[model samples]
Every structure is written in structure tokens, then in C-alpha cells.
Target: MKNALKEIILAAATAAHQKGIFPSSDFCEVVLEEPKADSHGDLSTNMAMQMAKTQRMSPRKIAETLIDHLDDTRGLIDRTEIAGPGFINFFIRPSAWYPVLAAIHEQDDQYGRCDLGKGTRIQIEFVSSNPTGPLHVGHGRGGAVGDSTANILSFCGFDVQKEYYINDSGRQIQTLGMSVYLRGKELLGETVDFPDTCYQGDYIRDLAGELLEREGRELFDKSEAETIMPCARYAAEKITEGMRADLVDFGVTFDQWFSEQSLYDSGKVAGDIRDFKEKGLIYEKDGALWFKTSDYGDEKDRVVVRQNGQTTYFASDITYHKDKFERGFQKVIDVWGADHHGYIPRMKAAVVASGYDRDQFNVLLVQLVNLLRAGQPVAMSTRAGEFVTLSDVVKEVGRDAARFIFLTRHYESSLDFDLELAKQKTNDNPVYYVQYVHARISSIHRKAGSDGLDVSGFAPSDLSALETREDIVLIKALARYPEAVETAGALREPHRITYYLMTLSAAFHTYYNRHRVLCEDDLKLTRARLYLISAVQKVIRNGLALLGVSAPDAM
Candidate 1:
């Protein structure tokens, strides 16, 4: 409907231009917005106001001139009015809204899908937690944000590939290995001093026990230094496998699991650095190779390789990002923890230094989740050797609630994920509230079917009976879904979908209470209402899918 209004405004301006009522046929894009007050009409646009200064006319005069030339041959507009300061308010005919139901039924799942991206190749890498520790609540939040953002962008017609970058290299892995090795020594009755630098998680001990069970006593013949890499490899691989399983359970599956070590193993890190050196992007300083990221956008030059001939993590990162663009991706996105906020400039600088536009790379930082029980912060159980792992939360509250709540706010905003609130079945729970809309619509259909009315699909009918205020409100709400999706995709925020779902659900609930759908005296009215709700059902399902949440037919 907004699009329709834009067309009408264009036609009016063009016709006025031809008649010399307006100066030029060329005009700025029409910007329409829902009026805050009910009296302002269904939608209002400031196109006239925007044009007044440029056309050397009063905004009111411009608005009046455009109104005179309104081309509503399709009967889309009931009437138009010039509001204060020359805002053109368009009150659409109630009959104009009837086609939305048919379009919804015709498109069904594809109703909200768009072509805003036009098939641009995009890669989104997220939840790349180090393979040393199990995934915490923060990683879970990052996963949900990434997966849902990918879904939204895909729905908006971007060619999206989800990726998980495994940080299985460098110091962290060695520490994990030492943690496991020291624990293994304890298991073998060796009086080994465990360093404070090693991991303290019980999972490390579990890994050590598993290693002993698999490799046995003979494997311990090697010195501690000799076995560190094997221990590191074992711990990393196992933890990564566990992370993969947990993420799958949380409704996140990446198209790629990129290994940081792969860049090193393929000699890409060395090769890429040499290329940068040749290009003078990298230089030898004090027996260390440094990337001149400061020249691009970074705050200062960063070392890629130290004097010890060991490459820093940034070296592998530079190679990895260059590999991303080389894979034919037009854009690359990463979801990272908020603690990594300062890392953005250097990473963007790396992209610029590596021959890609810095704008081609973007990062979505997910703030830490404040896990609470009821209204109180939940404490990790040290006695039980339990941390607030993502798997633990999912096990306690279920995936739908977890994912939905994780997306209830912008990723950059701190989210208070109340486990107790998530598990509640009442309307206070946003997930349940939105999901009940789907279930209630299904119940409506079930009642219709039980009454011997065919609930399969909607056909063209006299939807004139749907001229009530509640019906119009629902139609408007349904219409906003696609727009919400587009905005969310453009901004890379999936939380907007959650807001839309809640609003749509609230609209449907209001309509449901105010009107009845299966009236015997007015079969036409009943059919119209049923068709409208089926569209609501479809949209709710589609929205829930974007958040990786299920729309259960019955609650």
C-alpha cells in the first residue's frame, strides 16, 4: 500500500508537471509514514513539504497542486487531505485492503520475501568461539543474532552463506593442551604442579580422563613438551565437536567451518604476508614484520610476525579475510562479542589494505547476556562443576524461548535473558505471546473445519464484510511485515522481526476478541475473517522461522 501511494504521488507530480502546474517531472522519492495520531489518516507523506523549498512554492500550495492531480483510477484512495505544514495524508479505501488477503494466500511463505539485495553474494561468520572452552551464554547470543540476521538477509534476496571460524591455533590451544596434560599427569599419579594459566573448567579434567582412556599409559612415554600439540589437537577437536552439536541443537548450522590453522597449514598466511611485503603494505621493523594498517584506517601499525619468526593471530586474520573476498563474496560480515569493539578499525583497515573497500566488510557486535532466574542474576554452580553454558540454558528453557528472547533487543544492547520468564506460558512471555497467535489461528481453522467449512484456501469473494475497523487494522499490520523485514535486513538487525511479530500478534488478538470469525448468519464475513487470519498465521510462521523459532500449531 505504501508502494501504491508512492506510485500515485509520482503520477500526480508527473501529470502536474505536464500541465505546468508543477515545474519539473523529476522529483525526489516519496517518503510515506504511518501517522502517529488516528486523525492524520492511514498514511502520510512529506513529499510536498520536501519539494516546496526547491520548487519555490509554499508546502501547502504544493500539496494542494499534487492533490488536484491525484491519479486514483484503481480506487485506492478514499480521500486525501493537506495536514499542517503541507503533509499529504492519504486515507485508503477499505476496499483497497481486500487484495492483501489474496496476495498473502497466493504468496504464503513467500509473502514477505524481497529482492532488496538483488542476489549480492554475502558471507556472515559468527560464533567463532575458541575451541578451548564450551560455549557460554555470550556465544549463544551471538549465534542467534548471526543465524537470524542471515535468515532475514536471505529472505530479502541476498545470497548469504553462514560461517563459523574456528580459532584452533596459537596460545589458547597450547594452554588448553597444558590444562589437559597436567590433569592427565594427575590421573597418572604424577606430582605435577598445575599452572594458574591453565584452564580451570571441569571439562578440561573430563578431556584429560578421556585422553587417558583413549591413548593409554604407553602414550605417556613422551615428555610433556612433546605431547602438548597432540593434547591440544585432541582437546580442540573434541570441544569443537561439542560446540557443533550444541549449536545445531540451538538451530544454528554454518555453511562453512573455517579453521584458523588452515590458513597456516596452506602456507596462505606466509604467502599473503610476503605479498603484502612486496606491496609495501607490510614492512620489516626491528626484526618483526608489521602491517601498515594505520595507513588504511587503523589507529596504529600492527605487528604481523614477531622477532621470534612466529606469526601473530592478526597475520592469519589478514589472510582469512583476503580469502573471504577471493571466494567471490561481494560483502563479508562478522558477528563478534562486544569486547572486541576496538578491533573493528584494524580489521576494517585490513580489508582496505588487502585491496577491498572497507565498506565491503561489516561487523555486528553482540553484547553480553545477563542470565537471570526470575528477576535475580543466576549463579553458576561451582559445586556441581557447572558453568552457564549455552547447552545448559537450552536444556532448561528450550530453544524457541531462548532464541526468541535473545533477539528481543538489538544485538548491541545488553539483554537480560530471564530463564524463568522464558519458560512461562503466559502473555508476559514474548515468545509464547507471539506463538499463541499462530496456535490460535490454527484453532480457528480447526473450529471452521469442525463446522464443515472448507479451511483449505481463500478465493476471490465479496470481502466487503471486512470493512470493520478491526479488519482494517489487521490488514495494515499484515502489510507492515514485508517492510519490517526489509528494514531489519538493511540494518542487519533481527530484533525488529521480534518487534513486528509482537505487534502483529497484539493486533490479531485485539481483532480476535472484538470480532467472531465463524458466524453462521454471515458465511461471507466468516470466510473473509478466516482468510485474513490465515494470512496472519502464514506471516507469524514466517517471522518465527527468521528467528529460528518454531510456530507450533497448538500450544
Candidate 2:
């Protein structure tokens, strides 16, 4: 519908230009948007206001001129009016929305998809948690945001590749190995002092036990120094396996599980440093190789390699991004935790210094998630190994509720995930509320079938019987689905879909309360309402699918 309105505005502008109302046909892009109130109009545009300076006319006069030249021969619009400050308001005929229902039926699951991306090769790397520990609630929020964003962009015609960068080669992995090895020593009746900085999760003990069962007491025969690397390797593998299972249970599957170690092994990190040196972006300062990131907007220069010759994490990340661009990805989006917000400037500087356009790289910062139960904060400490894992949240609340609640707010804002509210079956729980709308429509369809109504044969003509105010409002709400999806996808924000679903669901619930769908005296109206609700069901299902939530026929 937004596209249709844009086309109408373009046609009106062209006609006015052809009639010499304006000096030339060249004009800025037409921007149409929904009005705040239904009384204003179905859609509003500021095209005339934008063109007023170019035409040397008042905005009001330009708006009137454009409206005069508008072609509504097909009755697509009921009327056009000029409002305050020369804004053109277009009121679409109620019957013009009937094709939206037909489109819903024809497209089914593919109704809200748009070609806004034009098949751009985009890679989104998110939830790239280190393999040293299990993912916590914060990581879970990242997963939901990343996965939903990927799904939305894919539906919008972008070739999106979801990736998880494993921080497997770091001090954390060595700490994980030490933790497991010390636990194994304890299992072997040896008194070993565990460091306070080592991983203390129960999963470490489980890994040690598994290692004992597989490698046996022979591992104990070797010195602790000799066993450290093996222990770390086994622990990382086991932890990564558990992480994979947890993400799968949460309905997130990545197209690639990129290993950070591979970058160093492939000499990409060194190659990146050499490239920066050749470009004069790298300089040696105080026995360390530094990148002049401050020249590209960073607050200060950053050390890429230490005096001891070991590269910092920043070096690996720069090469990783370079490798992404080299892999034919036109756009790269990195989903990082809010704590990494300060790291964005340096990373963007590296991308720009590496000869890529600044716009080609984007970083989405996902704020922390605070888990609550009945209004009290749930205690969690990642370092103490006492944090609530992602699997725990999924177990407490179903995946559908978890994913929906995770996306209820934008990723930039901190989320307070209430386990109790998420589990509720009432309207307070948005996932349940939206699912119930779908279920209610399914029930109506079944009831109509039981009454010997052939709802499947209902044609566009039957929709003429939908003349009530609530009927028109419901159709209008349904019409916003595609626009909502396109906007959300283009803006790289998945929360918009959740907002749209909640609005549509509320509208449907209100209409159901005030109206009767199965009118025995007015069979035509009943069939029309049935078709309307069916379209609503289809849209709800489609939106929920994009969020990776289940839309059940029955709650």
C-alpha cells in the first residue's frame, strides 16, 4: 500500500510537470507516510512542501496544484485534501483495500516480502560469544535480535548470511583449559589450587569428567603443563557443542561458525598489518605497532601488536572484517554487546583505512538483558559461573515467548525479561495475545465450516458487505503489515514487526468483541468477515514466522 501511494504521488507530480505547472519534471523523491489520526487521511505526503522552494511557490498552492493533476480514474483514492503547511492527504476508498485481502490469500506466507534490498550480499555476524563459557541472558538477547534481524532482511530480498564468530583462540580458552585441568586433578585425588580467574561453572567439571572417561587416567600420568593445551582443546570443543545445541533449541542457525583462530592461522591478521604499513596507516611507537585510528575518527591511536609480538584482538577483528569484504559481501553488520560500543570507532576506522566505504560497515549494539522473576532481579554473575544460561531461560519460558519478549523492545535499550509475565496466557503476555488472535480466527473458520458455509469460495465482491467502521479499521490495520515489514527491514530494526503484530492483534481482538462474525441472517456479511479474519490470521502467522515464533491454530 505504501508503494501504491508512492506511485500515485509520482503520477500526480508528473502530470503537474507535463502541464507546465512547474518549471521542469525533475523533482525530489516522493515521501508518503501514515497520518497520526484516521480523520486526517489514509496517507499523507510532504512532496509538495519539498518542491515549494524549487517551484518558487507557496506549499499550499503547490499542494492544490498537485491534487488538481492527480489521476484517480480507477477510484483508488476516495479524495485528496491539503492540510496545514501544505501537506497532501490521500483518503483511499475502503473498497480499494479489498485487493489486499486477495493478495493475502494468493501470497500466503510470502505476502509481506518486498524487494527493497535488491539482492544485496549482506553478512550479519551476531552472538559471537567466546567458547569458554555458556551463553547467558545477555547473549540470548543478542541471539534473538541477530536472528530476527537476519530473517527480516532475508525476507526483504537481501542475501543475508548469518554468522557466529567464535573467540576460540584467546586467554579465555586457556583459562577454560586450566579450569578443567584443575578439576580433573581434583577428580584424580590430587590437591591442586584453582585460580580465582579460572572458569568455575559446573560445566567445566562435566567436561573434566567426560575427558576422564574418554582419555582415562593416562591424562593424569602427564605433567599438568603437558595436559593444559589438551584440556583446553577438549573443553572448547565441548563448550562449543553445548552452545550450538542451545542456539538450535532457540531456533537460531548460523550460516557460518567463523573461527577467530583461523584468521591468524591464515596469516590474514599479519597481512592486514602489512597492508596498513604499506598504506602508512601503521607506525611503530614505543616498541609496539600502532594503527593511527584517531586519524579516522577514533579518539586515540590503537596498538595492533604488543612489544612481545602478539597481536591484539583488534588486529584479528580488522582482518576478519576485511576477509568478509573479500568474500564478496557488499555490506557487513556486526551485532555486538553494548559494552563494545566504544570499540565501534576503531573498527569503523579500520574498515575505512582498508579502503571500504564507511557506509558499507554497520555495528548494532545490543544492550544488556536483566532477568526478573515476579519483579525481583535474578542474580547472575558470569565470572562467578553462576549466571542464568540461555538454555535456562528457554526452559522456563517457551522459545516463542522468549523470542517475542526479547524483541519486544529495540536492541539499543536494556530489556527487563520477566519470566512470569512471559509465561502468562493472558493479554499481558503479548506472544499469547497474538497467538490467540490467530487461534480465534481459526476457530471462526471451523465454526463457519460446521455451519455449512463455503468460506473458501468467497470472492472480492463479497467484501462489499464490509461497511461497518470496525470492518474498515481492521482492513486498514491489515494493510500496514507489508509497510511495517519493509520499514523494519530497511531500518535494521526487528522490534517494529513486534509493534505491528501487537497493534494488529489488538485491533482484531477489539473487532471480535464488538462484532458478530457468524451472522445467520446475513450470510454474505459473515462470509466477508470470515475472509477478513482469515487474512488477519495469515498476516499474524507470517509476522510470527519472521520472528521465529510459532503461530499455533490453538493456544
Which residue pairs show backbone clashes in model 2? Answer: none
Give one digit per residue, the lDDT tens place, for model 1 in 361-381: 999999988889989998765
- Give Cα distance to truth, residue 23, candidate 2, Å: 4.5
TM-score of each: 0.97, 0.95
Instruction: Give all candidate RMSDs, comma-separated.
Output: 1.7, 1.9
Q: Per-residue CA lDDT of candidate 2, range 122-141, in tens?
A: 99999999898888889999
Whole-structure CA lDDT of model 2: 0.90
Off by over 4 Å in 1: 380-386, 453-459
